[model samples]
Target: MSYGDHGRPVFSSDPFGTVPPGGGFFTPGPPPGYPPQPPPQSGSVNLFATLSVIFAFICAPAGAVLGHLALSRIKRTGERGRTRALVGITVSYLIIVLAVVALLVWLLRPTHTSASVGSSGRSPTSSSTPVDAALLDGTELTRVLNQPFETNAGSSQRGGVYGLREFGTSDERTEKCVGVLHPAASVTYRDSSMRTFAYQQWSRPTGDYAGAVISVDEAVVAFANPEDAQKLLARATEEWKQCNSQRVLASWGTDGKFDSWTIRDVDTTDSIVTATVGYTDAGSGTIRMPTSRALALKGNNVVDVGVVMFRDPTKSADPETSGIDVARAILDKIA
Candidate 1:
């Protein structure tokens, strides 16, 4: 039996006012009815948490900040994305550390003779040693090729010149025996007028000027003392490291496609340092020819050789090895 608030007996009744044969009365467990239930509400997603993950790759610091904010918002609002936020934060820190380290290395690295590595070997401290008065030795460079070449088209000579202007990057940015070389600066076309006062110039040999899709030239210039050459080459290995992923305008074309150059391999032995460098089209990622370079200090003289060739992707026949062969020849000649 059930009782109402007025202390009256209560009974369940049909809407039509009919009663069952057995019974229609019911008993209530509580005094008042249960409160009505509320409907479920939707939750909001945290946008900061999502940004954290996206920026992690492109901007680490931003990702870290967004990740932390997202985590905080998630905890407070019970949103999702905890895993994404954490991942973004972790990656951001790692990238930021790498960026800092690279900057420090660039700021602290020795820049004194760094430009001469790519530019000219002539340093104010250098004394044009090793250059023989009678040894144009154009054949010395030609003899380096054990295999067939395009053939030497012609030859060139430069007396009292510090470095070979006829070959190499033609940029003074690597190591500057001279202070005016700028590898980052725009490149200019060199001609006969410029050669008169150029920092580097090499005499041409008989066959051809030795132009190709890729070509490396080697030569030696001695210092007044062996110690100077050794001192200059001390940081050659590190210098090559900076050469990786370098961006430059196409020397052959005005099409505005930049080339990304990289140093693939770097090695050092006593006073010698060698590396293989290659380039790719910055836009299409098309790999171009690669060059191998070796610099060695033989007594009071410094020998440099470079091998240049278009890479044959199908085969492993790298022409850069020719640079090493030429270096060996120079050593034998000096020996």
Candidate 2:
């Protein structure tokens, strides 16, 4: 140690052992009582921070633990991964909260099937009740038709259930009247105990676009009991009363032309409803075409018959078809 011109004490040399012309105290390292620190480390991403983000998708709980540890270490050690640690911690905690919420929702959700059971601990039976196959699909059902259908000239379709609106007029009032002419026109058929249905049609093959001169449609609808059949017939009779003198327009086949019908007369009895409908075939020119339909209920079955008889417009009188004969023949077989 030495004294400068100012009378201040100065070290002869720096701790590094080098001195200038003007003596001054110099420190190449920390002052006394201070421990040496490690070199200022370059900013590096924390291993836990990286793992936290990676495990957030694969294992969220593990990621949250790693993120918390990384952030604690970053704060205490003054490392360079503060941003990485914060991002990991934030993302990891957010995923954990979302997972917990989802689990709670699933655990608390309502069960629909359990609520539908009655106090008897039994589920309610389905509305659709299957019936005997022999009613609508048996050979006896087809044999009831009195019309002489040419060999292999008859085509039939049978099903366990049928919709009334699948065919016929769209207008409700007109459809009510049309239901007598066409069994498939009554939309309420499915509401009853209608178990099985069959539709049979026989047409004389004309082998041309002129269409079949005489075609017959017979539909057989079988129910579970005679009372159900009676109810449907009564309901149909009420609708038929409102359908008098209504014109119905409908399409025929794939042809672009349309056919029309005029309900001339509607008659209803205790168990039968009959109607005379005037049909005009768009392809057959402006001519008077007449059709008759009869619907009757007997026992547990209802039979509907439609007969179209096209006569020469030039002739004053022509042979007419009877729908009553066809309907009675089929209804007789129902019992």
The local distance difference test score of model 1 is 0.52
Show model 1 residue runs off by greater than 4 Å: 1-144, 149-155, 161-214, 248-260, 269-271, 284-286, 313-320
Scored by Cα lDDT, where does model 2 land?
0.60
> Where's the lowest-lDDT run of ten residues in candidate 2?
126-135
For model 1, residues 1-335, the per-residue Cα lDDT tens digits are 56769999766565555456676654445456776443232266678878998899989999999999998878766777778889889999999999999988877655434553422354324333334431224354445553333334453334433333422243447322111112111121121111111111232333543433244454555544545555545544455555544433223244444344555556664445666655666687655666666766554555666666656654323544655666666666564
TM-score winner: 2
Deviation (Å) of 187 in candidate 1: 13
Per-residue error (Å), model 1, residue 27: 99
Residue by residue across 1-335, what tens digits does model 2's lDDT show?
66768999766545565686564665477788997685465577678878877887778788788888887776656566657766776787888899899988876643225553433455333223222222232233234433234322435666666533354455655545545445444464857788777666665445532432366677777777655666787787676667667677654345554457666567754345777776655676333556667777655677777766666544211212366656766655543
